[model samples]
Target: MVVRTFGISVLVTIASLVVAFIYGSWEAVALCAILGVLEVSLSFDNAVINATVLEKMSEFWQKMFLTVGIIIAVFGMRLLFPLVVVWVTAGLNPVQAFDLALNPPAEGSGQESYEQILTDAHPQIAAFGGMFLFMLFLNFILAERETKWLSWFEKPLATIGKLDQLAVIIAGLSLTLVAEFLADDQHRATIMIAGVLGMITYIAVDGLGSLFHTEQLEEDHERDVASRAAGGPSTLVKATGKAAFFLFLYLEVLDASFSFDGVIGAFAITADPIIIALGLGFIGAMFVRSITVYLVRQGTLSDYRYLEHGAHWAIGALSVILFISIEYHINEIITGLVGVAFIGAAFLSSVVANRREERSDGDSTPKSGGGESPSEMATATD
Candidate 1:
């Protein structure tokens, strides 16, 4: 199962290495390898979060994530998004932007133009992606729910969530505050506009998902009563078709949010867009998808409860980092390590919880040595 899941990743890695070798020398290949590792490490939390949503989706959508979704992640986000950023920031044609990326300015020119263009656009990118991610975290932590990993924080937020659209309010205020941090008037306006767009995108996608929801709808009011009368909790049935489409959209956006950092950080390693796409887009993206699928098939989320919570928390941290990075440059290595630390802590907590449950179950079992139930003693004697 593991090999089957990761087969494409292995192929992608090999193909990227070969492409990198052709692109330049062993040095290029090594850079590709480093970028690939960086991408996978930085996005491990993304895989975990993707699995949390993907598990709720139907099998067909799951397959689509590997096929159609991979194309978007690799080509759309990794390759084309950078060019688009350059184009928008530099006010250059797509061809010119692509050329600039392929052949950067000389080293002694203080900094590479391609990198500088991307850096110039960082404020807008951070505002957009950070707002989107911040909303995701707000929704998760604020939504009214009984299952909570971080009780003190989540409980209060859930209580606040009782007020309708409070997450949006908090998120909007957050964007305004962050925007104020930008000293340049143009940069501040850009952040505000981008932040609003980010919030709008989230609301639009969420509304679309609700609009398309049909599986839980009742044909007759009588049926709902009967369903409620049953002792079991009512199941929220989602229509396979509409639900999958919305889920696919959500997954794509989620992937894009994760890729924003990678796209910018790739410039730090190499100015060549093709190599960046080959390394982070092809190989790294494939590995993340593979991990998502593996987690779903193996029921890893069920086994390690709180993993999703950890991933979301990691996302929240990343979102904060993204916002801070607009004014201050934070190292990609630091970002990656922070995510790993959160995930590792969550994993350890899960392990401890599992052990506690095992001990409780063991203690609850009827023992023959003590005054046990007659049935247990009979079974033991038999």
Candidate 2:
């Protein structure tokens, strides 16, 4: 199972490194390797979140995610998206933007390089990606769930979630405050517009998925009831057709939100778009996708219980970091470490919880001649 999951990523990593070496020299190879590791470290939470959504998708869509989705992620987000951002922000034509990326302005030339242009556009990017991720985190925490990892915090939030569009209200206020205080006069309006657009994008994509998913649930329930009456085995109701399409779209947008930081952060390592695409797009993305599949196939999220919670909380922290990054330069190392800390802490908590449950079950079990009580045995079996 491990090899089946990671074989492609391994092959791609080797190919990417070879390409990097051929493209430049051993220095390029080293930089590519470093960037690949950086992307994987920064995106572990992204893998966890992707697993939650991918597990619901049909096999065909899952295949598409690994195939067509990878293409989009590699070229579209890693390569073309940065070019497009440079074009829009710097008022350059397509050829000019592409040329600028390929032939960056020399340092001390008093001209803006591709990296500088992208960095200058950070306010807008931060506002957009930050709000999108913030909405995702808000929706996850605000929804009432059977399992709560941080009950002390999540319980009160869930209670307040009874108010309609409370997430939107809070997000709106947060965006307003950031725009007012963090953004300067020149970019204030841009940040506000971008943030609102981010909110709208999240609502549209997530709302469509929920609408179709609710219908799918009703249909599955009917099918399950009919199957039970006929005494046949019931099958899992995975999302397919239009429902899967929307979910796939949602996943891509989510990936884009996650990639915004990685793409920008890559400039700190290298200005070459080719290297970034090879390292981040090919190598990092493949492994992240593999990890997502492995988690789904292994039922890691179900077994750990709080793994998903940790991922979402990490996302919440990343969103805040993005907003903070607009005004201050945040080191990528800090962002990566914060996510790892959350996931590690949650994994430890899950281990402790599992042991406690086991002990409780052992204590409640019948001993000696009593054997096992039928009800207790049934509960244990479940």
Candidate 3:
């Protein structure tokens, strides 16, 4: 199962490394490998969140996610998105932006390097991505659920969530505060606008998807009841057509939001666009896709009930880090480790809970009346 899932990612990693070596020798290879690992580690929580969405999609859409989705994630987000950011922020044409990326301005020169332009634009970028992810975390924690990993914390939040649009109000206030204090005077308006747009984008995409999904559920329930009345087999219904398309679109946007930090952080390691694409887009993204599918197929989220909660908490931490990074540069290692710590702790807690449940079930079982239970008899004979 592991090979079936990660085989393509491994092959792509090798290919990307080989290309990196050919492009700039062993140094490029090392940088590419490091960036690939960095992206995977940083985006581990992204995979978990993605699995929760992807499992709702039909098989055809899931296949599209592996194929068409990867293309968009690699070229669109990792490569073209950065170029577009440079073009927009730096006021350069497409060709000029590409050239600037390839031949970055030297340090101490009057002109800024490609990385500098992107970094300078970080306030707006961080505002957009951070707000979008913050909404996701807010909605997750605020919504009531049957299973609670952090019950003491989540229960209060769920009660607070009963207020309509509470997530939006909090997110808006948070964005305003960040733009007012954390952002520079020149970038403040832009940050505010970008953050508002991010919130709108999430609302539109998630809202439309939920609307269609609820309709689908209602239709499915009707069909199920009719089928039962007619004494016919009741078929399962999965999201497809418009419903699945919106879900797919939502997933892509989520991926874009997650990629903002990783793409910007990669520049700290190297300013080469080609190398970054090879490492982050080709290798890192493919592996994330594989991990998402693996989790869905293995039912890992169901087995380890707290894993999704952990991922969302990690996302909340990341959103805060993104805001902090706008004013002060936080190490990518710190960002990645924070996510890993949340996921690891949740996983261990889940293991302990599972064992405790097993022991409770064992103790609660009724004993045979005629004699000692089989297990007790065996122990007595021993």
Candidate 4:
């Protein structure tokens, strides 16, 4: 797995650099490398989080993840998603937007100016951020209640399967409508709509998954219902495959959550559609792949027990920040930094406690005799 991941990364790096060079070397190269490191660092926890879901998947799905999923992430989501968002927000044709993003007023000032203009022109990113946070909050709560408890009381919670995809689609349309209808009215309503829409989307998708899910392709409700036959419990029974699909949707939402800040931040850096696409796109996809690889290879979810917990907490915090950005913008640096700090503190505490326990144990060894050794007795007495 490690070797394969590394090989994939190398191939991607080469291909991305080729694109970057075709665009021009300096900014693209620098941006790619920087975003590479930044993404790698920011998404380390994402890999571990994904592993928990990925392990349960069938080999075919896993293979699809490595092949088709990466393409969606790299070409579709990472590259095109931003440009599409920018085009929609800026109200420019793709050609103009691409050109504007690619070529700005000054050489050194290309990045900053473009970002400022994008921010000024669009103003909907705040909506995306806010919406992402709200969706995540719902997701985490639903995930928590359902996973940690299986009682009948929690049965209603199982219906939460609908919220993941709902968030993004709602966020997209809400922002689009806000940019359109409520241009100057109650600005906050946009956030509310986005939030509610995201929630509904999640519910719709996951609920459908639960209601119509099946392990066998032919046994599914889509098939059985089409045949006009009442299928048994096995027809709608949720398998890890369905869960994996939702989990993939959940991860995409999470990626969008992280990218919401980074996307907006791209304006802060450079808005060259090609630059953004080639640079941030490369880095983001690479990091996502690297993260998935790390989790699979290192088995961090198994090894670093608290890493997943920490990241989910960070995701939860980020979710709040996203919602709050509707009224009070949260800086991305602060968001990532605070998350790192919280997790770092937790990690350090774990390490320190581990070392202290090890030391105490070392000093409390039993002697050959049935009675405790002097050191052991002294340590015990102390």
Candidate 5:
């Protein structure tokens, strides 16, 4: 299953290496490889979070994630999304933007390259992505869940989540604080507008999912259907198509928020759009998708119960970092490591929990096979 899941990633990595080697030197190849690894490490938490949601989706929708979804991640976010950003932010035609990207201006030129222009547009991007991700984390933390990893923090938040629109209010306040940090009126306005749009996108996507909620059949009918499916008569569980569509949209947006850092950081390594797309887009995104599938198929979350909690916490951290980055330059490596640390700690905790459970189960089990204890047998006879 691991081989099958990573098959595309393996192929893409080899292809990226070969292309990099042919295009320049071994140094280029190494850089591409590093970028791919960087992307994976940075977004591992995103993969785990994605799996938690994807597990709720139908198999058809799951398949769509790999097929249609990968295309959007690769082309839409990696390739065309940047072009769109340049076109919109710089007020240039798409063709001109594309050319500028492919052939950026020299360092000595007074005019900035497409990469620099995009970097200059970072405030707006960060606002939009940050707000969206902030709300995502807020909603998760605030909402009531049967399970929790950090009870001290989560318990209070869940209680606070009961207040209507608390998440939105907090997000708005966060934007206000960010606005205060910025000196430029225009940049502040841009950030405010983009952040508002991000919040709206979340509300719209979430509301759309609720609006498309399908009524389930009666319990008797569900039981019969489940029995038939389990008995190998019926084949599949039907999923609500409209709900799936909204979920898919949510996944795409979430993915974009995660990709903003990767896309921008790619310029730090190389300004070549093609290489970024091939390494980060193709190889990195494919591996993320595969990781999501693996988690769902293996029921990893159930086994590692706190993993979801940790991923959300990592997301919250990332969101804060994104917002903070607008005013200060934070290293991409730091951001990635923060996520890694949160998820890694959660994984270690889960391992400890599993071992504890095993010990408890072993202690409770009967020593002899198919036999009652002497005490039990004597009591029964009495």
Candidate 6:
């Protein structure tokens, strides 16, 4: 699988180069390379979190991730979703909006085209990213801890929640409303609030699952045992339903988080819808699928719990940064770099933690571990 993935990566690089050179759009190639690398680096925490959560999924669901999940990432987010955002935010009919995108009016002239409007409103995007950053921080910091809380209300608050899918839908709608009511200059805060609400909704559901009164796991040894015990071929039938649902939802959201940066970055490269849709669609979907596969087969995440936490935190940070850029008018490159830095720090911390554990054990090996090996981990799920 590793070799195959590497080969695909090489092929993609070559293909990107060929396409860029052929179209005489050396810029596209550079942008492709930049965006591709940015997605991977900034998304490491995403990969770890994805792998850890995906471990619970059934094979069919994992397959769905590679298929349906990709459609959401490459094509949906970069291509269709943005158009939807444009139409809803700007209140232009689809035909007119797309026409604007296709033939963006000249810069500084304030043309009628959607692309021109978007370009004219480009500072609005950065401002959105900035507000997104602060909103994310609020959700992470003020939203209360999910694992264990200091107060009693936390548990009741958690257990009363419904499906996480609802949260995504609501957040999407909230963004639409924000785009509707808020002016370009003032929308960053609105974007941030929407993002925070989205996260709060996700945690509300997942936290409810965690609050289900499972047996407490106290030690690494116990966790390792539970991890090993989770692996019965017989369990595959039951595991599929739970695992697939989580994996699908996870992939969908992760793709959205990833595209927040990619879509914005793509605008910097070129606003051509065809180019954006085609290039981003194929590339984003492909990499996300590849990432899902790596997590499934390798089981690397089973040994690295903190890594997933780091990724989520990084994602949380990126989301906030994106929201903030909406109003602050910061550069897109800086936003990407900040996210990349967060992921990088988390990754380095993971590597260090892994090495420290290895040294402590006098062996650079991780004993297979997870929540499934014992009744405790399984109970944690239930």
Show model 4 residue runs off by greater than 4 Å: 1-3, 103-124, 134-186, 205-243, 327-330, 349-382
Candidate 5's residue-wise lDDT over 138-247, tens digit each? 99999999888888889999998999999999999999999877526769888999999999998999778756644322333576687887884643434447777887
lDDT of 1 by residue, 1-382 (tens): 9888898799889988998999887988988898889899899999999998888777778888889999999899988898898888778888999888887878897744877888889999988999899999888888877567778888887887989988899998889889886536879998999889988887888678666654434432345567789764565553467766887898899889888888888888887888898889888899989989998899999999988889989999999999998888899999999999988888888899899999999899866667888697789889
35-137, model 3: which lDDT tens digit per residue? 9999999999999999999999999999999899999999999999999999998899878988998997777789988888999999899999999999999
Q: Ranking under TM-score, best-scoring first?
A: 3, 2, 1, 5, 4, 6
Query: Which runs of model 3 end up more than 4 angstroms from their true locations?
Result: 369-382
lDDT of 4 by residue, 28-95 (tens): 77776666555555555455556665665566666667677766666675566665765776676766
Candidate 1, lDDT over the whole model = 0.85
TM-scores, all models, native as reference: 0.90, 0.95, 0.96, 0.67, 0.90, 0.64
Q: With candidate 5 superimposed using the best TM-score fit, by how many Å does residue 223's alpha carbon deviate from the native? A: 8.4
lDDT of each: 0.85, 0.93, 0.94, 0.58, 0.87, 0.56
Candidate 5 backbone clash number: 0
Give the per-residue lDDT of model 2 (tens digit) for 55-79: 9999999999889999999999999
Error of 1 at 170 (Å): 0.9
Which regions of candidate 2 fall more than 4 Å away from where they truly are?
Answer: 370-382
lDDT of prediction 3? 0.94
Position 337, candidate 1: lDDT? 93
Backbone clashes in model 5, listed as residue pairs? none
Better of 3 and 6 by TM-score: 3
- In model 1, the runs with Cα more than 4 Å from the true position are 106-112, 214-239, 369-382
**Backbone steric clashes in candidate 4, count:** 11
Preferred candidate (TM-score higher): 1 or 3:
3
Please, what are the lDDT tens digits per residue for candidate 6 over residues 26-136? 776666666666556555555655666566556676667666776677667777766876787788776767777877778678546555456444444433443343333
Note the clash tally of each candidate.
0, 0, 0, 11, 0, 39
